[model samples]
Target: MSTAPETATHFRPVPVGLLRGRRPAVPGPAVPAGTGVEVRHPTRLNAMALDPSKIVGTAAADDGEPRGSGHPAGELFVVCDLFRTARVEIVPGSDEVTTTGHCSRPVLARHAASVMRELLGITDGLLVHTEGVDLPPHVGLGSSSATMASVAVAINELYGRPVEARRLIRFLVDNHGEEIDGRSDSLMPVQCIGGSAAAGLIPGSVQVVAGNAVPLLSAGLPADYRIVLAMPADPTEWDAQQSLQEEARHFDDFLRTGRRHAPDIAYRLIHQAWPALLEGEVREFGKLVFDYRFRMGSIKNCSFSHPRLLEFADAIEPAFTNGAADVLGLSSVGPLFFAVTRTEQKVTELFRDAGLRTFAARPWSEGYSVVKSW
Candidate 1:
């Protein structure tokens, strides 16, 4: 496979407005006989919505209703890490969609089918094997959306499409609207494709995704910034589709009451931390990091729900004491906490002191890449 096209052009800022209608479909570019392509999508740490108030009704809706009330407006920051990622391999000419890889699951297969039907309009056979990292469901690392984004990029490459990572993210958000509710589809392009961006709606639309990459005030993180992920040893992965769907429904109910929590989200992210990131003021940004952990979790009704998670969050305070970490927060919901440190090695030792599973990572700068094609 040839290298992935530079995504800067793909991620360029689109005009702020509701894009009308689905894009027209065209036949995928032909590939040489027996060609196989592999593509990679990174994982994310947190997705901080700037104006939490506008999160629900911002992106253009796919159902043909006016995208939203035409008033909601804000951005979201997709904090990404390359420590764990989804790598998907695509082999064409199969009779049906066949998948293999630790990240490969039934839902993933279904999503691939849906992508094929909706994006390529092809019912042809394709074998897709996902590799790298076991993405436990709802881990808050944007794994599900990253998986979809990875496969989407792979398929795009197969068709020789030069779609932007951001556009693919929006495309997935628009097409798989309902499937991504309560999930972080907006952040997928940020993680799998690289760069931390502030994505939001222009008005009259709702992004309606947990991981879809949205428009950003800025992309990428400051140089020399470091991150450490403290995940539970037993993720106790949820395998039940019904239970997950129930969670999604409850999440929708929670969003209906966004007024209750959106303000805090806005203050911490948009008013405070967003500037801290831009100005390279880690300490000021660190304070918002502490506040957001509690506030964002409360909105999810799971703040401080896990003893190990709390214990880790508490024990790592010594990091601030020792001049190692400048900021600390939980990633998404529960059981995955992160620290912004001067050095990854120092944070790793601190996690050791707390007896937690940990990995050293940094903010990813690049998005998806094609490693091989044969």
Candidate 2:
């Protein structure tokens, strides 16, 4: 019904050692009478953690067989702020992904309204309104993707449409997967939604999900811990699909060659990352994440990192041997680096005093879910 706020300033970064709870609910406009449904509890998107089985499913294109980790990746997760997930809801087995779903959540209602006011091509005076806590702005994480998938499911249910996973992924990909210079929003949600989200660069399959592993949960961390990110340089801009294609080629080659197999590693790590994160072996998880990103980058003759960022990564690697830190990488990409460490005030202060910013992330197994409809 109305435009989303111009900026997402309501979200606040966590304090160095605390799981900074989300900001107080910054309320938005009330849903106008019969305007549209509302969705809630969205999260940022996560990087794809590949599964070898899902990667090589028969449903995939025959161009070449994909390699899966036998399991999948991109499972363990966290949330910043999620306000709405909406739009299309195709019937299951209806094969509507390519045709039925809506892209651009947090903005859809406004888009619907604009169509009513200006386009007038097929208007019945339907106004879709979206409002909620502004999400954390970008650094490459999957905020928009989560928002879309959640809203798609919610609104689809509201309209009595049931979406199949495969089609839903495709719809999100089609609208969002554009060139950086063009219109795509990284289509980050495609893969973020399914076991392996829609990878525009890499081919995907809709057959039964591949892999034979189950995600395990833990009661709690051995001790309190915190995640710290180090931004060494400014973030960079690049085309996602092109980069993904290049990464996929390397992975394809790895599947082809038993020698130094990256595809297999990516697949294995996808499943492994879940337990590792649950068990709090987050330090190794970080390095594994870095290694995975690097190996994929090597396929394209690009390092998986910014030079300065790598330095920071190395600076923390030794801690792994001593069990000082777990997990590492640019929080989003290129310049920002992250490490998981037991909740030590000193560790937090280390990043803070060094003039780097940091925040806290809890283990989030919950991805995006539909909280309500109608």
Candidate 3:
């Protein structure tokens, strides 16, 4: 059993510049309209399943009503320093959107077209090009969300900054069905707002309500903390064969029979883990993160469906036990597992020794920003 702190000596004051209750103003491009706009959106790690019930309910109806039942549940996430870049430009032609580079997925092209028609009401053809980090898709890095966010921000910029970040977030969340393929969590508000560099720690927990990402707690990790990621180069057969509809069915199964742990998960996130993060208690936060992963009903089912993921989790368990890392867990339904540590190189080497591909990323402090406009 643990007791609350008796004194203020142990915790640092929240950084004044890091407070983030309100939405940050979206920055505008200096370049004139119709110029090519490029924006970078950061990737994220779903640190814990705050509410498994909300995962399937993220899709909105044609009338913009959220499609699921139950009270909205929050999620714990970390914005990784990795980013996907998107550039959008208007072209002379009929009303269609085409994508090039790593973002050639038809779903993304359709999303761009929808955003354009819905927001600016332009019918002109547009070109969207994206550059991705060296990681593959569907490995739990939030790559698709980042790419879509980048494209959405670029489209907004290309049309003279008509949408604010919050409205843009709602639009994206409302139309997620057009982009997402399988059953997965809703488009996190963090994916659209990006991490605020000025917010220091970023929003450690958030709940998606009516397509808005409502921040529950905002805090940062200790200055010395780092995250090391290891992703298996190949996905399991179950992961590979899973279609959007199949994934949705999985969510349905969880809602029906697997959500018994939601209460425990919520308590840990709200009362335990969140406070630990605020006080810069990395080890405590990490322990909660590690435990929270298994507490997620969907992720527990995933461990059985994708047993290879468990093998990877097993391979890295010694690092936490030995204290080389402070935090350890899978990122989303993953081929990717992350260890939070002060010893980045050591943990990264451990993953490599286990025959996994690895990278080290800091907690990104800033959200998406316009990188170039011309």
Q: lDDT per prediction?
A: 0.49, 0.36, 0.56
- Badly placed stretches (over 4 Å) of model 2 are 1-35, 41-48, 51-138, 164-176, 179-226, 229-233, 237-259, 263-307, 316-322, 330-336, 344-347, 352-355, 369-374
lDDT of 2 at 99: 19
Q: Give a tens-digit lDDT track for model 2, residues 1-374.
A: 21112111121121111111111121221122222444553333232233321332222121242211122322322233223444332233432122123334424233222211221122233333333433232444544444434444444434333344444444333222222334321222112223222211112111112223222222233345555544433444444444444334333433332234446655555566546655655554555655554444421222343434444555544444455565444432334444556744555565565545555544333334445433
TM-score-better candidate, 1 vs 2: 1
Over 244-329, each residue of candidate 3 has an lDDT whose tens digit, in order, gives 33344455544542267677766766677767767777777677677666434445545543447667676777888789998887
Superposed Cα deviation of residue 52, candidate 1 (Å): 5.5
Q: Mind sharing the TM-score for model 1?
A: 0.68
- Per-model tally of clashing residue pairs: 30, 34, 8
Provide the global lDDT of candidate 3 against the true structure.
0.56
Strongest candidate by TM-score: 3
Off by over 4 Å in 1: 1-34, 51-61, 64-95, 101-103, 174-213, 240-261, 267-272, 295-300, 303-308, 317-323
Residue 23 in candidate 3, Cα distance off native in Å: 19
Clashing pairs in 3: 181-244, 182-244, 195-366, 195-367, 196-365, 197-365, 197-366, 201-220
Q: lDDT of model 3 at residue 45?
A: 76
| TM-score for predicted model 3 compared with the true structure | 0.74
Better of 1 and 3 by lDDT: 3
TM-score per model over all chains: 0.68, 0.50, 0.74
lDDT of candidate model 2 versus the reference: 0.36
Could you tell me the lDDT of residue 265 within candidate 1?
58
